[model samples]
Target: MTRIFSLTCLYILFLLSSCSIINWEVEPDNLKITYQDEELSEIFHDHILRFIDEAEKRDMTFRSGKVNIKWGPELANHVNATTFSNGIIKVNPSSVKINHDHLSLQLISHELYHLLCQPPSAYDHRSRHLISGTPYVSSLMVASSKKGEFPTIDNVEMWEYYFDELFLHHGDYSFVYDYESNSK
Candidate 1:
């Protein structure tokens, strides 16, 4: 009887722990992409493919939903991109120009991270204070960026670090609340 109880407890614990584990495999066939500009569509599709490859390598799990990407009008508040909890991502092409391919990738990756992680509002953006002090210095989820702010497109190390932080540290929101506290 004791042996049975121990085994049942272990089984319950395993089931509970597995619930928190994310399944990182992504099916591209599950995604439905739409865009208004041909050039932007190509860039967007390439970014999504690259994101899937990277996610697979890391075995990162994203929330399960059919992703819908579409071109949106110029966003209010100077925002270039926005994501919805329902797996919709809208990018303002006028704000994210084709010449700025690196910026486009950054925006797309940032939005994708939001969709995949479903992080609370506290983790929405990496705080500037945290960025200055941590290995997450070049996090793509920085609240804002200038036209030429992104690293060169071929900077493998930087890109790798950004994705690593996005997938590996998505749950760490240490100093994020500190910023809120101080602001208030």
Candidate 2:
């Protein structure tokens, strides 16, 4: 009788451990991310957390849904990233340079902007017009460089400007010509 009881207790403990392991494996976080390369995973994850923190600082709240991100195939027009309405973001790995932290943050934050902002159109640049000065595009949503490049920010001030433009500004003042001139 003692032997049987001891074996039964061990079996029960094993079953409990197994159940917890399964739960941990299947549980989904707010952001369900998949990366093509394991080395990029941690870097991207840290950037994402920073993005969320910045958004919250601007009083922006994300809707309740698990955003799924994955490394996707080469995007059309050499874009670095694309976000879908259904909370999916695909990053083009080829466009990302592993050692460029600023560029990587920009790419991830740009896509997160799309996912969280849900602008009227996927291509909305949220351009702000000047009443009397030269019109310019300053938002992060503005099209990227046509040569598969993004403008490098030389200082923290420029980075802050882009972040503010993305989170605080609204309305599109882009002319038809602006659309053709900008590339993403």
Candidate 3:
């Protein structure tokens, strides 16, 4: 009886997972507009501008930064944003599905970091040398522990950490933040 019950439970879980509505496909140079919502686009644009402003103030090289954003359902099993090589960032628009402005600036900011540091050409071998301080494993751990809430602490740390690292790569990193405390 116990074995039978366990199998039944497993089947139920599978059914639930299959029924989930979120799905998306990321393609090169193409905007996958999920849910086809116009209002969400405007709201995301405003936040993107704010992110650009902050990025510019920190580093002038990114002053002319522009990114293509495509909205879609929170398709990834993990509720997060991603930047593709084609200079586009994909955002899970579920939070804004109800309240258009409920989006988080941190999401856009984090992905923008990826977009900026991307290699200018496919032939640039140095692109692989750059590191994303927020490792996928750590991000997965924090995501599972919080059950989909934003990692405020990690987000803030990443902002400073990535900036310092980026500056250091260019040499003369006097402007970079001291990472002594990060050791803790």
lDDT of each: 0.67, 0.60, 0.44
Question: Which candidate's TM-score is highest?
Answer: 1
Worst 10 residues of 2 by lDDT: 22-31
For candidate 2, write residues 107-134 as lDDT tens digits: 7887777766664264465443332222
Error of 3 at 8 (Å): 65
Which residue pairs overlap in candidate 2's backbone?
none
lDDT of 2 at 31: 43
Per-residue lDDT over 71-136 for candidate 1, one digit per residue giving the tens place of the 0 to 100 score: 677577487878887677887766744457787788888888887666535447875433433333
**Positional deviation of residue 88's Cα in model 3 after best superposition, in angstroms:** 2.0
Q: How displaced is residue 145 in candidate 3, in Å?
A: 8.8
Model 2 CA RMSD to the hidden true structure, in angstroms:
11.9
lDDT of 2: 0.60
For candidate 3, list the clashing residue pairs, or say none.
none
